[model samples]
Target chain A: MRKFIWTLVIVAVVAVFGGRAWYLHKQAEQNKDAIKIGVVVPLSGFDENMTDRIVTTLKTATEELTKKKPYKIQYLFEDGKYTVKDSISAFNKLKASNPSAYIVLGDLPAFGLRPLINETKMPTIVLVSGDSGLPAQSPYLFRMSLSSKDMIQRLASFTYNTKHISDAAIMKIKNNYGDDGSQFFKKYFADLGGKVIAEETFNVMDMDVRAQVEKVLATNPNMILVWGFGPGYTTTFNQLSELGYKGEIITDFGVFDKAVWENIHNKGDGIYFTTIDSQANKMNPQFLQNYTAKFGDKPDVVASFAYAAVEALLKTIENPKGIEAGLYELQNFETAIGKINYDKEGEPHAQIVIKQMQPDGTAKIVKE
Target chain B: MTYVLHQLIMISIYLILVYATNLVTGLGGLMTMAQAAFYGMGAYVYALVALNMPVGFVASCGISLLVAGLVAWILSKVVLRFRGETFVLATLAFQMIVFTILDNWEGVTGGSYGLSEIPRPSLFGWEVSTVPEYVLLSVIVAALITGVFWVMLNSPFGLSVRAVRDNERAAESLRISPQKQLSRAFVISSVLASLAGCLFASYVTYIDPTSFSLTESIFILCILLVGGSGNIIGPFLGVLFMILFPEGLRFLGLPDESAANLREIVYGTILIVLMYYRPNGFKGIYSVK
Candidate 1:
């Protein structure tokens, strides 16, 4: 009796997994005619709101595109949870869906899937701001977001030339994004004859950055550059305000996250951030209005990039050339973020602009 | 087919890791929280050697094991002085120290940007580049490690370690050096973990500090706890349940918006219920005190 029960349990376990796999395989077969795009994004963990926006924007764009296009497009999303292991798992799970192309968010996911991308030779679009140079490593990999080098160049130029800031301190998250921002800002700022007086780092899970903030303030630099993502930025901003240092503050487009500004409240006002050009909004005037009306919230730069990825993929599908060749042939492709151009290295060159946060938790372009 | 291969490879790598954890925590009865650190050490060392040196995959893995073993030996010397929760805390501190080094050592480890473009494992002109090839390599490695562990555990050395685990005073009365045996188990456990790390780095061809965080250490410990420890079959059961079951949840076709969270919830709940019903795990002989 005991032996029979154990056998039954084992059979049941296999049946559950086998049943699900068969169901998904059948579904994939049924949708064989549709162009499947696998999207890996963080649906949990840090930056959930940001990924939620990406999903919403992708769905909205795909819905609109499918209605007008000749061929149907299908997007299958897998939750990467913004980590390397989960991203790889998500990618593998999405493979069962039989996607022709893939879209991975963040540097970690792109990096994790780099080897697999090479192995599979699937055309993948990576939406990442950090200048990790991953897109250049794989021919099939194309980057959709602005590079950190370009954004830091503009920020450094503005800090030195426009604002006349002679020295700055950096408080950055201790990851690829933070490392790139700090490294690039230092290099560009030094080239522009400005000095980085001090640098402090904190982990993403760190809730209190008072120690790091205190150290940065101790340097007494003319401007402070804060580079990070997620809710941690709010803590940094609030702590900076608590420290009561009267100096200029600057960050990246990550500051535009609603969770950050709303939590930081008025503390985020007067801070400048480098982001994709506001011309992106001007090019698609209806995007902001439509996104707001549908989602009941404003779309940030990340949403625009996500929407643009869908647009770029659609263009590739429409082209007579294949995914890889079509991607390279794309020139001045219209997207929510204005016109995007892909260089020979598969990295998209988009205009970057500096914007200042308003007291009402909105950003306005800094007029040069 | 490729996805199945990928999961198999991952399971193989994690099986080695769980075996490493099970050796010290299950048999030696010294709960460790630094498996991921040793794992990371193995990966980084393997990546560095592979990228910079002319060494092949075997040599890289050998060097990684040597380095991780040395660190584990040194760590064992310090952490072995403590017992129970204090020992666990010491191991946890070591984990944090290693993570900090990996995160901040920009010049060498590439810091948080991580070391990318890691070459696939090649042994004397035989490369494990393809997914199926990697699956085969990983499975062979996992099997060899399992065989070695079985031999080690069934030997007199294993009996002495278990004796010390059950009662250190009684084992010492029997002339079994508790400190020496435990240290050996710890070092051996860590070296095996580093081996898994090497396979993972070469397999993924990319690794960052985030891959070897404290969370991972806790997860490895959880695997041993849930699968049962202090025995050979326990680690295998733990690996299958801890790694594959959560992955199997992905196929449930849950709504995308809540799928990740839902999977986590269901997984967590099952673990809790399992522990509540079977405190020592499915096949565990010794539970952590």
Candidate 2:
């Protein structure tokens, strides 16, 4: 009798957990006609406000697509909390909720997720930019955000081909994004016949860039490349001006915000940044206007990236071949961020525009 | 399901960490926060050894054990000189120093980008690659560590450690060397933490500075305190509550925008209530003063 009771208890335990799993799987199956997109972002942490805008854009994109398309679309957003562990946890929960998602949208560094992505074979679109090494590690992973390597390469090419700078110096943050960018810039710039005279690094939370700036200034290079994000990106440029260096300064789209320039008293004249053409508010005027009216602020780069990722995912699902048809199949696809294409490795093949901040604190497109 | 197996693997790792922390903080009466540092040290040591050396995963684990144990011994010798708050401060300082080294030491530790492409653990030509296989390995490792800890707890050394915890002066009066007992406990706990780290690195196949940050140490401490760790089973209970509480919030039907914060608030509230009502924990033998 005791043995029979033990067997019953074991069976009951399995039935409870197994029933929950079956219910979840059944719910997922009911929405077979809908294309499910799982989004993971820092919704309640350091980048919460910025992520709110992205979420808003995601909602608007989905709503607009649902109104136009015959099939319904579903989205599940989870908080990554700006950490790799939390991101993985969020991804797991999202995956459990929908076992057969078309694609997952994530906005964290992709170092920790590569192994899992390789194992699961789930096509994920990464928003955070850096040295993902995705092409070599996991082919199913697609980087929707602009690549830091590509940004540096474009900056290097522009410096060599257009500015005719033979010598350069780089100031980067002492993290993966900066390290990868610095390495890529040096190699690409050197291969393009330019010499990097000096390279220095600063921590992300560091307020003091004077020592690094001074070290780079001592090199007396014709051009300077700065790799950083947030307000600190402008700090390198300000410190350079304070030291009276007159070299052309280059950075990524992280410094494209006019608010960043306004924060600095010096205005850091002659500093340029690489950005997508969508920042000009030339494409998708209706969507931009709607976003501005809704949020009282224009949709920034974060929103643009979110919109483009959703657009790409929607298009890929419509292909009937899914993401496996290869992101390259969406050749010259017109996205919210203008004409965009992808190479065989899922990297966007698009135009990178350079914008320079004028002495008056206004930025104008310099190179397209 | 793979999801359940994944959660189980994570729980096993946390269980090991919580058990190690309990050995020192719960029984040895030391408020040390350097477990995360030892854990990261073991992971980095394993990753570097496995990748650079021609040694297999077992050899890498052995090297990690030796490296982490030695470092823990050296750290205990230096920090155990102080008692109470000063000792806690020393551990905090050591934690910060370790974190800084891990973040800045790009040459060996891979800096903040983290070490990736870590090969999966293989046991005697059997590759533990699949989720179920890794889960089984995790359970076995956790069980082995627990078994070793259980044996030690039933021995005279465990009684000495607890005696030192109850009253160091009394233990000394009873001819027990308080310093020796404390140091032994600290070293044992730190080595076990390193073992847990090796399992973590092998299972996750990647790690970063953030994983071994001060936040993680505090989280492990929460597992001990909230679980009311004074006995062997206390750490298991603590690990279960801490791991499952936050995860349980996923089913609350909360919006994504508020889910993370709400989960923290709920988890914190439950812990506070538990500490107030049941300070000795559910199955703990002693209450934290």
Candidate 3:
């Protein structure tokens, strides 16, 4: 029995690795003529709805690009699962394909891949809203979407100048996203002489934020800044409503999701959040129409970013210079999201706007 | 080639982790869920020192090992008083506490934002920067750990620990101190785990609290359980299987939409089947209860 088991284990190991090697060779041969663009994103483990939207948008955009481009463009995706270790693993797997460029989603994967990107000098575009400093870490790294710093600065300025809010409380999720949002808002708001009277935090997995909401309400601030993503948004909004706190509530881009509004029901009404400027979306109505027609639903901000990333990559590839050079030279490049301009640091600047939730489960632009 | 080297590096690191874990859970009969905590501690210490102190990789690793071992020694004194399920729970609590500290101590740990720009490992005018170099360094460290563990586990101290694990009262009657042996085993296990952590930090160049969460500890424990722990070869086999099996599934050419989920399902199913067939693991002399 012992000898048989040892033989079985050895056979299994040999079969797995050997099969993988064969499969990789076949894949390489098949895609030999195509321009391979590797995509590393969370295909599992974190925010399935968002991943689904991003993947669908990439597929749609890629199909459109394939028809127009002179050469074949193939996208090979590896699931990063939105974690550092898995992101590194995913990038390593994709490295075997020798892609012309890479598209990495989220902040964690970008940070994890920064050193590798510097080493390999791969022209990679990261679609992220948090941590504006990421693109500075690597010359080959380019960013899409308005960074959290930009959006929060706009939001803080709007709050203090337009809304005349002097004091505020903050309720943020406990992860990096929440930390960035809270820290940025506090710094920007404090610079404008606004006082953050109270601050509280809850985990992303928390089903209840009554204690946190109540703690914030006890401070009796003029407004509150809620920063986080996922179910926590719904929970925070619902708890605030249950507690009968009627002060002005502002949030980050996370509340733009339909799921959050639906989950909070009417509780999210009158809440304000910062997101990409709607003027750009208005400028390109056909993208919204095509996405809705194709997917049978409207595209969220994340999907728009994904679509824009593909468009930007296609434009960069068309340039006479290489991807890295083309990325640095991009200015006023129009895409599905809006016109994009990459500074010398490879960080793209986009317009940010604030929107207010309505009782009908839709949001209206309040500030731009 | 880099991808292959990356996997080999990860396997080498996990080998150290599993071998260290075997000392406490496999040989000493103490199931610990705090390996990742010590692992995180080591990584954080190494990262902080390397980033701030301008120390070489060897000194950073030494400091990490020392800090992790000291914490493990203190924790062992408190947790070793309990037995079985209670001991496991105590270790779980420690893991949670460590995770919270790493997650909330934003000033030091960067909170959940994670520490980035960690310099690569260097020793005596040689900088290990490339993936191949990292792979070689990790393998050498793992080999040295294996040699030390091999000698230690074969010594009389190893026999005494096993004797205590099998029957603490009997070992005590025979003049062996259960507390002393178990504490030493636990501390040594943690110190080795920290070394693996140090290697991981330098190899990846980025780490966040999520990398060292409770899930990772469970994953490490699972590797030991699946491979059959009480001995060196058992955990070694477990490390290769647990690390490579999931990675191998990635190459099966599943559809992109369902591939990640499918890989997980298949991996879980295989684990269940393996455990069902071999309760004590393929080559393990002792089964974790």
Candidate 4:
């Protein structure tokens, strides 16, 4: 009977406490004047692992910004889990609660929300897909993140501006992304009176490109331009080695995957590509140190890009009169990625760097 | 801005998921984790077919139905032979396979990034332009689902499905081929799932692997269980409850990240509560869809 009474008392306390907890939760939920900046990310499955580095970056952004701007930037994180429908569903849900949705950060590529965005006029600060280089019909969408076109443009311009090479060959996937990047180079280099002796295209998913690389190498160009990320890049390097083709290589940012690098470690010596950020760079000790302490590992360019996006959004919403003025400030703010800025539509104009994988299997930017 | 429009829209989506999952689990009594696979198939097929095709709304739904039904027929025969846990595992395998196609077939389905900017159905010019209008579309779909489920599940034909669910041998001994009833349930579920998929693709304006996750399948199943499986109101309440309650938590002055995690924890806790007190799942009509 004594134990029973004690148990009954414990149960009563738990029940009362639980009831109070829920009531307070409900009461707090009803409060207005709480400004919310919605966020979406691919948080599970294949994209699940991608969120670890990004989540830390997100945590840091809010914590850091609150020190300066207090609680002005309210973070509402929605998990899109790399699904386009889920991302839109998350956005729709956010809009339902906070309907006058302002500055959002997520990978809202043009193709995903193009029709809806064109209709809604919601000021989305999207981590974008295509660039201004696409066909004119890509809409009035303002991307507050770097584009593949911009990255390639900087890669081509810097390589040529510093007179890095006069003759080079290009190899890429036969897709719009690679094809568009190639056209930019073709137009820019030809105008500059430089020689792009050979240009080749391979299937997008196919990683075996020995014949393709050899055909480009057969042109006897000064450097080989490879434009595939991940496994495709690894395959090109291995094939280039097997064919014993030893000239300079210029590729896009995608080839920097660790497994891809390891796959081509022996062959990646002196191979050149371009990237927005790097994990190995201990130069910016502040971010890397914080990132290391939290995650117990180095941060990837993907994570850095995500952080830069949140940081830009923070600066935008936390300004004197909010987004419009914040966007004005964001357009010119400089960072580790260069003088980062956006046009009126919130698309970022960034100066990309060309990084070379040295003989020792580490990457270094070509300081132009 | 009251999102009565958005809530109605969500009602339509989970309504389809509920009846479809009901057909396999509620009626056919197959605890499928692969309904998400069919839903995804329906989504991708709808997007791909509608891209260059001149198919209108009903036609788009029809195509999705046929495609998903065919896939379901194949899967049901191959995987339904196993009992209980093996069946669930088979469906899980199917879900993973569909996810693989969505993520790896980048050129066709745009890979893991997915096919985006799917145009809204411009069916003969009365545009389903807004979310409210889409909500109406969803209501019609739900009505169709209710009518169809009513006819099939209440009919003697549905009894055979229920009969198979309770005891396959008993249904078989009664001259009702368990295989035949199971096949019909699979087709019906797939068609319903495909319709939802088509609507989902049209409403969301994009389709990717994320839409077809095992978690999504489980979420839909939770809707079935929480709202009391086999009842129409159960799914709606489950969906509405799941979507609104967590979002409502934003009012409290916690940091953004804490609020987000708390929302997830609350969702988990709600499930645990429903499980502990109401395992037959509140409505107790537990005979599967």
Most accurate candidate by lDDT: 1
Candidate 4: stretches off by over 4 Å: A1-86, A93-101, A108-115, A128-140, A149-337, A340-347, A355-364, B2-4, B105-108, B122-125, B230-237, B250-253, B287-289
Q: Write the per-residue lDDT of candidate 3 for residues B1-289, one digit (tens) a residue.
A: 8888988999999999998899999989989999899999999999999999987999999999999999999999899999999999999999999999999898899888789878899889988988888888999989999998888888988989999999999999999999999999999999999999999999998999999999999999999998998888888889899988988888877777888888889998999999999988878999899
Instruction: Tell me, by TM-score, which candidate is best.
Output: 1
- Give all TM-scores, in the order shown: 0.94, 0.86, 0.93, 0.67
Best by DockQ: 1
| Model 3: how far residue A300 lies from native, Å | 1.1
lDDT of 4 at A42: 51
| Residue-level error in angstroms, candidate 3, position A149 | 0.9
Tens-digit per-residue lDDT, A169-266, candidate 2: 99997777888789899999999999999999876556668999999999898888888765456577677788888878888876655456565646
Judged by DockQ cut-offs, the docking class of candidate 2 is: acceptable
Worst 10 residues of 2 chain A by lDDT: A99-108
Residue-wise C-alpha lDDT for candidate 1, range A1-368, written one tens digit per residue: 99999999999978976887788789768777888889999888776777778887787767766676678777899888888888888888788777889998888888888887887799999885576476788899999898877788889999999999989999888788888889999999999999999999876767899998998898888899998876566788889899987899988888887777678887889999988763444424455566788667666788878878877888888777788789898788777677788888888888778899998887889976
lDDT string, candidate 3, A1-368, tens digits = 99999999999978976887788789778768988888898887747667777777777667765675677778898988888887888898999888999988888888888888888889998875577677788899888766777878888998899899989998988887777778888999999999899999988778988988888899898899888776776788889889988989998767778667668887888988887653334423555566688656677777777887877777778888988898888899876666788998888886677888888867788943
Candidate 1 local distance difference test against the native: 0.87
Interface RMSD of 3: 3.2
Please identify model 1 stretches exceeding 4 Å from their true place: A1-30, A278-290
- Residue B134 in model 2: lDDT: 89
Q: Look at candidate 1 and tell me the lDDT of residue A303.
A: 84
Candidate ranking (TM-score, best to worst): 1, 3, 2, 4
